[model samples]
Target: MGGVVIAKFLCMAKARKEYEAIVTCTMGCAFFGAPFKGSEMAKVALLYSSVFGNDAYESLLSFMRTETNDTLDEVVSDFMEIREKLVPKIELFCAYEEVPTDVAYAERMVNSPKMSSLTQHKFFRAGAKKLMEVGFSGLPGTHFVTKESAVLPGTHTIGLTVGHADLIRFESITSEKFVPVKMALTSMVQTARINARKRTSGQNLLSHKFVNQVRRSLEGVDMRQKFRAKVEQRQTTSWLTSEPQYQQWMAIGDSAKPLRSPHMWLKGGPGLGKTNASLAAIHTIGQTQLQEQQTESAGRNETFLAYFLCERSSGYDTAEDVLKNLITQLIDQEESLAQHARWFVPNPGYRGAASDDSLRSDLDTPASGAKATATVDNLWQCLQDMIEDPIVSSIHVIISNFHLLDSGESTTALLVKLREDAFSTVATPRVNHRARWLITSRDDQHIRSHLTAKCIAVIDLENDREYGGKVKIARQKHAKDTVTKLRQTKKYSSDLASYIRNSIESQSEDEKWIDSLCLLLGAMPNNSSSLTIRKWLREMSRYSINRLVDHARDTILSQNEDLTLEIDELLQTLTIAYEPPTLADLAVLTEIEDIQQLTELVRKCSPVLQIGEVSEDRNKVIFGHPEFRDHLITLYHGDSEQRKRYHGSMAWRCFKYIEKSYDRGQNGDAKGMRSLALTERIIDDSNVLVMANEDEEPDDAGPQVKRPLSVARTQSSTSIDILAKDFQMLRVSFSTTTGTSGAEMKAYGANGSEIFRQ
Candidate 1:
């Protein structure tokens, strides 16, 4: 019908001789209409010529014609018989028809003399004008327009609207496959709908600032980066995926009715790779869903993957944090869910208001009275509403370290309620949404007792023989890989390398222990003689993980008294830290003024404190293995005295850092330190201060002065002074009814006399 299409057909036919078959088929197609004159045939022939240029299309039409007799009437009957089969052949034409945008086409129709002659009624004219402005693609819903009521069609267009039909067909095609034609049709259809919605809703609904505001209010960490780091560093094997239990679990999750067994509890001991396995499962689900989103089944169901990693010292150890985190993740994927959190906005003008107090209120603790309970209830209700939203197809939640949840029973009960909402009841044949939960935790009796849903599938990694075998194999492979690399780097003899490999493989199937052992082995001095390596390799298998850690610790501490003290300082600081500290923060906390000095200390303690690059220039320090932290804690034997000293040292260091930054006019650093100090509870109470004279003895010391200190962040503050007087040493203590009391500072004058007491 268009000059461009005719030229394209002529160009294609000239390029390929086999296109003559398409021309024949086009001629046959044109025979269905009016008399087949030469001029008339050219019009229909060119229209159908580009339907399909391949032999398959021609052969199908030929087969249908052969089924009928050679008579003209028989041919026409055959054409009618296969017309249904050939209807989809017009997809390309429909795709071409999308070249003119919906708005453009609407304007053309609105101004057409033919449409005016066909329908001059007021309603028809008005509807056409609306279409010109909004376009057929911009129609909000099926209710946007309708045909004549119950009698004659005097006031409106007849037949199903071409725009609605085109929209339905375009949506189906876009969801079903990735055809090049979809780019055009989807822009005219799907994108138009999205644009219409965007126009109807305020632009701020999708603003980055709005998203960040909601994210901060939830007080949840985005664990995607953390998981990605783990997944990148760890080498995964298919043994876990190939296991029967895992396969069945995956199958059920992939099923249409995943709610039948919505919860999967993966219970294992500390050293096992439960976290690793959970990461792998999340990765697999994410990849599968991403691939599915480009297939026919994509439109049938949508899947959202949300996960949380709970760590005890990371401050993400509460059930409330988990609910908030999952809700945040869900709402991030679906913005409509944010409406449920409207109550959280303390001020009605919060949309554009830049108020820090309001934002901080959202993260307040239970000590704040009824607001805490209200916040938790609101979060729980928001989570429930999200799960019940009909727009959501399925939500897969993968939570690791479930046992670490502070309020396990309450969290478990909330989870059970959420499961109920996702699942169908006898009264309701089915639920519109599904939620699949994959939880990993230690085999704690308390947690097991609370997670007793009949629908829950429990997989115990510790006791399963097959799982144990897989872990052993995976560890053995890991050992071989590590030894192969170490052999080359350490330049060991082939025999010695083989011996080291054998010793490593001979260790237990604990992934953490193997990793720790490998780290220690890698950290061994490359210049060490072959005999030394051989001796260490010989003793490795017989040594338990604790003994190995102890050996490493003693070796590092035996270097020198000052270095030993520095190492102790580093370890103590790392242990008490509320979150993993960057290298600069660690250096400040350890009181190591020199960067090189702190770097050396980190290297010496590499076997215990793992150093990872957070960025190109910044490094984060964390325990290389949980066993090492356990060993250190056991060695301390709950040394409350040393713990208090460590806490005091950290708090004082944070204060000093902030003070120095302020003195240097480094406002950014000062502000950062202030926030960090408050978050870590280094300067917790608002009205608290410490004062003492480290230079004088208690017998002749000056009067002790007490002053109320408020460490709450103030936007306009330029300088801060929490101490009443300049003192060589300060002591602060914290007491709580919640079993969190601790002595903070210990000070001794020149005569070694205790100068202050809380």
Candidate 2:
């Protein structure tokens, strides 16, 4: 109310100064979803959401460092506080409204149409108030101090009911077309009013004109449209692999058990179905929300927001890019918020206020245009503000190919911030009522460490050490499910469907071949898409199923123009990007012309390399799927000379990235030299092992760890002059550090000065 009122006041002030009509009784305010307080439903709803939010936090603590519990504890405490604050506000409003008796409220809620119904709101607000009071006196029926110990499941039916009621309501209506006649009439009435005001009011005195600087200041400003993902085109939710194990994960939002972790990290190797699982889960959320809308429950509304990072695409590599895209998507969902972006927009005219020197100061670049936007500070603030909005019940953000982010201070910091904000909740009665984040990444230790440190829920598809047998069973069932779904598609003829089902059911050995088989099926010829199951079976009858799949894989790798060459390129790139590369960095290396090119390549390399996920335009790439990477490495090592040649190419690229300021260089040169030297060694080493063995140089044997470098300082002019007279060209040597097998590097000049020593 304050923000809207201020904006209107500014408009009114302008109108008074000039004859223009700006502020009106009706402007942007349309619909608002207010959660109820003091009702039975509110108490249950708060508990269920809290439990669901904490589910992953508890489950994944063991996977993380013990110290993370402290961070996780702080987050949970803050969320409860949020609920407490909000419930009271909601109750104060509903107590004055015409709230119905509890029984009538329930019946009224069941029959409400749109989310704006008075009776339905009465129920939600009343429930929220009741829940808030319970928090004050201790859980309404129980006195357990610990959130975990309070409230039994079946004994408290309200938990389930409230869980169903707390979904956030955020819908974009500005995009809808308004009735033309109504709009014309409104415009005419406005014009008539303006004419009357001009005739009856002010004398046209001093010639003074003032443009509403606010509007001009934000000319062409729009953050909502800049970033979006083509998830629908990639393969709607149905394209996802639906296994029983995955089903348990998707059902977490509805479950009463407190989330062991605050968020879920869906871990998997490349191409093993992490994104598909995410998509499937997202689809399920959509369905759940749709059901709520249909029922007019006004209890809960879940809004899904996702950003898939692609390496070959536009701006997905950097920390800043991800933040911008995430914020953009959220704003796009709630069009009313678009106005706030204008408020944040810098007043361009203000630059003229400062002297030329200060205006020219480059230390802090003004984020005034499209190129400079979304600072780290404002990015998180914008998201938090949106999440905390009363109408936005719950925001579920899904980020796929999370490992694609280049390892750096910025990326790490951004991840930490995301983890912290995942716990921000709606105030007073429903704190868990705000947002939760879900990510999919390879099992990279660095990435894992950061998320687990925040006590995030982790569900690794490939990490099956505990229940291998059950996983195998699930895999078999998954394969059957795929076949069943495939049978219904238009591509499968009745005969082929029967034959496929028969072949699948008859196969005695469940070797966990579902994913591979699905990959093979997808990799089949373009003509295969139209091939009836009968024709496919007939073709298969000539050769065994394994042989057929092998042929298909070979065909994809060798004969397919669209896929073969693309896969070859992806294989080579991933092999060289052995360490993760920022999506933008890879794009430059691969010379990717557009996101479609990268998307096409990833599509071609499926079942082998998850390579990366490209967003609508920006691509974020990550190298993973150990098996796929190893296979590529084996091929790369297939010919020793080829491997050496590739290493040489990579070495040259690394050198290009190095800041070649010899005189100004200090410590950073050593780090760059080490990387360059290692690449050189890799090229020089004969018979390079795809998998390191005893024959390999001990220095380059194990996984590498990157240490953040100190800020490089310029050497004194006197030192530079003295060194220049005696110095020769730099010489780099890559060798093992004192205690680790990991290759480290050092650099020297002719004077034998340790120019870069680490």
lDDT winner among the candidates? Answer: 1
- lDDT tens string, model 2, 249-329? 344334523334446777766555565566666667656656654642222333445454433221444465566666556
Q: What are the per-residue Cα lDDT tens digits for candidate 1 across 633-719?
A: 546525534454455456667555544543322444332122222222233343222322232223234553332332323111111
Q: Against the hidden reference, what TM-scores do the models get?
A: 0.60, 0.38
RMSD of 1: 16.6
* Pairs that clash in candidate 1: none
| lDDT for model 1 | 0.53
Q: Which runs of model 1 end up more than 4 angstroms from their true locations?
A: 1-209, 248-259, 292-300, 346-378, 405-433, 529-531, 614-618, 626-645, 663-705, 710-758
Clashes of 1: 0
Q: How many backbone clashes does candidate 2 have?
A: 61
